[model samples]
Target: MKQAVIFAGASVQPEQQPPVPAADLYVCADAGVKLAQALGVVPDWIVGDFDSLGSVPEGENVEPFSPMKDDTDILLAAKYALSKGCRRLVFYGALGGRLDHTVANLQMLRFLADHGAQGVLVDHAHWVTLQRGGTAVYPRRDGMYFSLFAMTEQCEDVTLEGVAYPLCHGKFSNAFPLGVSNEILAENAVVTVGRGDLLVVYARD
Candidate 1:
């Protein structure tokens, strides 16, 4: 299974890139081409309306999509990545933009997850996801914090381990802040959910 990374046109903070495993393909979405170039990484494919791309990279791999297309640039990039046989797609610069775009990107998580692709949105201070049924683990960092927010109407049978506050088979609702500001206690923290999707945000304090 090939791994792919997609970059979107959002404000990226310093030290936002993690040590991601080298991807078979790197995709740039619209202005994201400039972001990739600034980072000195040439993407395998670039897809977007090109309105935001000031100078197109000198390559045939750059494919321009219509600005009036129904899908967002990032979403188009995700589809391209999947078409290239990528089983996992990691996203960068996916947050801190227009609030509508950010929320739309979050919804894209469910789209990818439903299609059997593992999608993660990494930003300056946090890694966010709307995860379905699964067991997620967070490796320990010196001063990292993990928070989970219920994205759907409710998340059932949720559990948290190795944290300042722990939960077991608990239910979380979208209207409350029941799972906010939890700290890690062990080298690796774990969260398990039996049903419903969770919006998890992990950050460094």
Candidate 2:
């Protein structure tokens, strides 16, 4: 798979770093360069307005955008990744710090899904992704909490198996968090969404 790994937002704690897989492309969003360096990754491209970075970084790899831009720095980085033909994107440091930014990243994942790609937001303690009207199987994690939410107004014919609380063809709504804090019971969990999008999250304590 052609994958891109992007660094954005606050630096992750050393102990909280997940097992990051190697990607074909790497990108940093402004101040995210600091976190990229911490991870020993040399970004192929750096995209941002330089506001968070204090000053424009002196490098030919840096792709500076105006601060008055409509999209966020991370979103710009995502666009660059897509332009490079990367369909699987993993974003580090995309959570925490500002609550609004975290929400924005989630929206970015939805955007990727709409564009025939998939994005995963990795933070200090969470692995989040989006599922669009399809089936997904997740490997069982002994102590982790698995949760799913309706990203659209309604997700119809949602089925969940191999979890502590199983659902059969249930209609999920964004208005209610009915799929929160479930645990994987079988060797793997199967989630099928007949319509609409689903926001899936795996959290560690």
Candidate 3:
């Protein structure tokens, strides 16, 4: 499965500027093109309306979508990546600025996960995702915290390991904040969910 990295035009912290080499297919969403270029990584494909791309890059592989289109720029980029056989997408600069856009991007993860694709939203302080029924592991980083929120009705049979507080077959709901502020203990921490959708967020203090 080919991996695709997408850059979105959101407020990014300085620590998040340098491009990380995790995906072969790189995509820039509108203004994200400039951000990627500034990071010294030219995108293999640039997709979005021209509104944010201010100045275009002189090259092929740059496809422009209608500015007045129904889909958002980030969604367009994700769709294009999927069309190009990308199985996993790592989105950078997806958080910050408008709360509406941040929530929209979070919902997009559900779409990707439902369609047999794995999508992760990366920002300066958080890593967010909708964990369906699977096990997710995070390599330990000192002073980092991990959180899990059940976005749906209930996340049943959830388990957590290598954390300050552990759970065994626990059920979580959107109305409750039971899974907040858990710290990583071991070299790696594991989270497993049996049913419902969960939004797992990892952050550093």
TM-score of each: 0.92, 0.97, 0.92
Question: For each predicted model, how many residue pairs clash, with residues at least 3 apart or on different chains?
Answer: 0, 0, 0
Q: Model 3, stretches more than 4 Å misplaced?
A: 55-58
Where does candidate 1 have its weakest 10-residue lDDT segment? 12-21
Tens-digit lDDT string for candidate 2 (1-205): 6999999967567457776679999999989898888878888999999898899888899989899999999999999999999999999989876888888989998899878899998876788999999899998866789999999999999999999999999999999999999999999999999999999999988
Write down the lDDT of every candidate, Cα atoms only.
Answer: 0.83, 0.90, 0.84
Superposed on all Cα atoms, the candidates' RMSDs to the truth, in angstroms, are: 1.8, 1.0, 1.8
Q: Kindly report the root-mean-square deviation of model 1 from the true structure over all alpha carbons.
A: 1.8
Candidate 1 matches the true fold with a TM-score of 0.92
lDDT of 3 by residue, 88-161 (tens): 99988788857998999988988898788888887667777778887888777665688889888899999999
lDDT of 1 by residue, 1-205 (tens): 7889888998775355665458999999988876676666778898888776665556789888767889999999999999989978888878888899999998998888888887888865778876787798877665667788887899999999998899999999999989888888888888899998898888775
How should the candidates be ordered by lDDT, best one leading?
A: 2, 3, 1
Residue pairs of candidate 1 with colliding backbone atoms:
none
